[model samples]
Target: MSNKVTKFFGSPWGQRVSLLIIVILVMILFQPKFFSLDNVSSILLAIAIYGIMVCGMLFVVIIGGIDLSIASAAALGGSILSIFAKGSGYTVEGFITGFVVAIVVAILVGLIHGVMCTIFGLPAFVVTLATQYVLLGAVLVVTNGAYIYHSDFGVFYMLGNARPLGIPLPIIIFLIYTAISAFVLGCTTYGRSLYCIGGNPVASGLVGIKTKINTIIAYIFCSVSAFFGGMILVSMNMMAGAATASNAIGSVLTAIIVGGINLAGGEGGIPGAIFGALLVGIINNALILLGVPSDYQKFVQGVIIIGAIALNVYTSRRSENMKTPLKPSKKTLDSAQSAKL
Candidate 1:
């Protein structure tokens, strides 16, 4: 019984179970009322939006790339959507047109990153960092540092705020994307190749993998996902502002890290990413529920992110050590030699 218990606790799912239990205990002690259906739905709604962005980050990280431009790309996409929706006149046709244009802009940004990384042999970090600045500058230029409002698109607002059968659309969209991402990462050859490339680019290339193309595809996925996240943000707020969207960077990175994804890549999954986002969302909601001051929230978030990353590193190292071969006893070695003789 003890061995069984130990084995169970040693499993990944078991660790998750333990974490969930701890979370439940903390909530029960700190804010027992948070377990309500309404609160749960609200948390899900928040997670849905950020979770989508985290999913994109997961793709980038899995392919051993980082996208510093995701936040700005999202901002740009949302801004474009708002700009076109207002300037092209008010109609369903205009809304569709604007939405398509916004998505195209995001894809183009992603293509630039891909080309820069693959063709020019630029590091993804450098490429994305530069693109981040470009995107921020573009947003400022396009909107002239003003918020773009789309008061005419009432139906579009439903994408972010409306609930159908008590389920938020964003949450639905999140689940759909999560499902697709999980499938792609788990069941597809492309997904397997991402792991291979991240694990060892040289080996992957030697094995006939199109490493460059795969890396490019991964960045495109990240940018497109960020674009979708921006669309949701615009739909929710009914406005897009150049300066404000920058605030999401810390939270997005926190989610990706807390979800147990290594910054170095080749290890982590969508479930881990989702759990990380949920953990952050819950922590924030709990703070609000406890009536914590808004000014102190940033400090608390920073502390939590640090703690999560530290824990992830410790556990990952421990797991790696556990997988190493145990040293053979002298008696065992002698027995093996005698048997061979």
Candidate 2:
């Protein structure tokens, strides 16, 4: 039984199952109505939105990097999509074109981020931090301190409001993206390279892996994830503004951390992150049901983040300690004797 428990926890799928069980138990205990069809749909909706971002975020995090600018990128994407999607006219063809343009803008932002970090050899932390601010400024500039509201959402509204076959469309979209991301990460050479680079960039480079190229690609994907999530947010809310992605960075990080992805990277995958998003969404739902203030909710989330970080550090140290110790070469001893003589 002990071995079985350990083995079960060892795999990604097992971890997700365990998380799901825990979330279900918590919901049952605290919010009995959580199992109702309406409440279940709401939970799934939140998870779907977050899952979209995590699908993309998994790439960046697995490559031993972070993308702090995701929220800002999403805000800008949402704003652009709103303008193009419903601003002037609601023709289906025009909205589709505008949506494409907004997505392109997001990709361009990601490209710039990747170039600055990979090509210029800048620290990921510093680069992403700087880009976050820059993107924030861009979002503000785009919105001009105002929101673009669409009272009549036209066809674009279907993205958020549609529930085909009683399941939200966003959830379907999330599942599709999840399938693609999982396939890429689990079945492709690029995915292996990502793990290699994150595990040890220097070693990957020495072995002929294009670390810079992979890093660039990872960042681009991460930013694109932001855009996808942002567009969903706009569709869900029927509006876009500078605050479109507000608190998004924190929320996404929370999902990653709680989902068991190591912040240092090269560990975990899409499954874990998706489960983590679900767990976080559950927490959010519980909080809402309990009528907890937003400030207190933030504080609780902060505690969760700190706890996850501590766990990551502990596990990392334990792994390092478990490794075999290296022995010194004989040449080093000879050199020491010579120096003493």
Candidate 3:
């Protein structure tokens, strides 16, 4: 019992589980709506939004990189989708063209991120930071700083608004994407290369891994993921705007960190990311239910993030310490020999 307790406390998985339980208990105490079917459905839907992005962001994080431009990427994709579909009268051709174009742009964004970092020797964070503004500026130029609304999503309506098997379509997509990501990371050569590269780009290059190419691929995945997320958000709102993802990076980072993926890369998986995303979803819902004022919610959320980071750091260091055995002092060794004798 004691060992199990220790394991639960010392491991990220166990800690998240405990945190989940505590959150549930608190919700039950202070916010009864937390358990309602409607509320549950809403939370799941919300999770599917950022959840999809988190899943894609996993590849980048595992490669020891960061993306500060996810919000802009998402905004651009959704904005473009709205514009194309609107221009063509929301017809099937417009939808198809918009979808393809959005994908291409997403890939291009990722390529830029990867190339600048891998070839030009820029820091991932710095590259993404610069790209964030660039993408945002592009959105402003394209939309002329206006929100584009679409009256119809055509066939795409199902992706954002439908609920089959009592699950929101976004949630379903999130699950499918998560499964695919898990498989690719767990079972593919590319996945293994990503891990290796993230562990040490220089050493991996010596082993014949194309670190630059893989880094490019990782960034593309991140941008593409953000694109999908943006589409879903636009579908739900029936509008695309530049500010849609303005505050999203912090949430995504919190999810990745909370999920047990090391910020340093190559140490975490989709399971942790999912848990972290869901945890954020639940907390956000809880705040709304608890009547926390909008002005203070951000502050509270920051505090929670700080706490999770400290806990993750503590557990990571503890796990590392456990791997290295202690060397006994000479005095202790001599005392032990005498006692045994």
lDDT of 1 at 165: 85
Error of 3 at 254 (Å): 0.5
Candidate 1 achieves a global lDDT of 0.82
C-alpha lDDT of residue 185 in model 1: 97
What is candidate 2's lDDT per residue for 73-152, written digit by digit as tens?
88887887778767557678767887888778878877887898788878787888898888889878877878888776
The model with the greater lDDT, 2 or 3, is: 3
Measured with C-alpha atoms, the lDDT of residue 71 in candidate 2 is: 85
Judged by whole-model lDDT over C-alpha atoms, candidate 3 comes out at: 0.86
Give each model's whole-structure lDDT: 0.82, 0.83, 0.86
lDDT of 1 by residue, 1-341 (tens): 99999888776557756776787788888887899988888788778888998998898898788899888888988887777767767566667887888878877888888889888989989999999999999989999988887676465777788888877889989999999999999999999999998899889999999988988888888898888888888888788977545645666787787676877878789998998788777776777888998667678768877887777677767876775568565577899999999
Give the CA lDDT, 0 to 100, for residue 333 in model 2. Answer: 75
- The list of candidate 3 runs beyond 4 A from truth reads 294-297, 316-341
Q: What is the lDDT, from 0 to 100, of the residue 186 in candidate 2?
A: 91
Best by lDDT: 3
Superposing all C-alpha atoms, what RMSD in Å does each candidate have to the true structure?
4.8, 4.0, 5.0
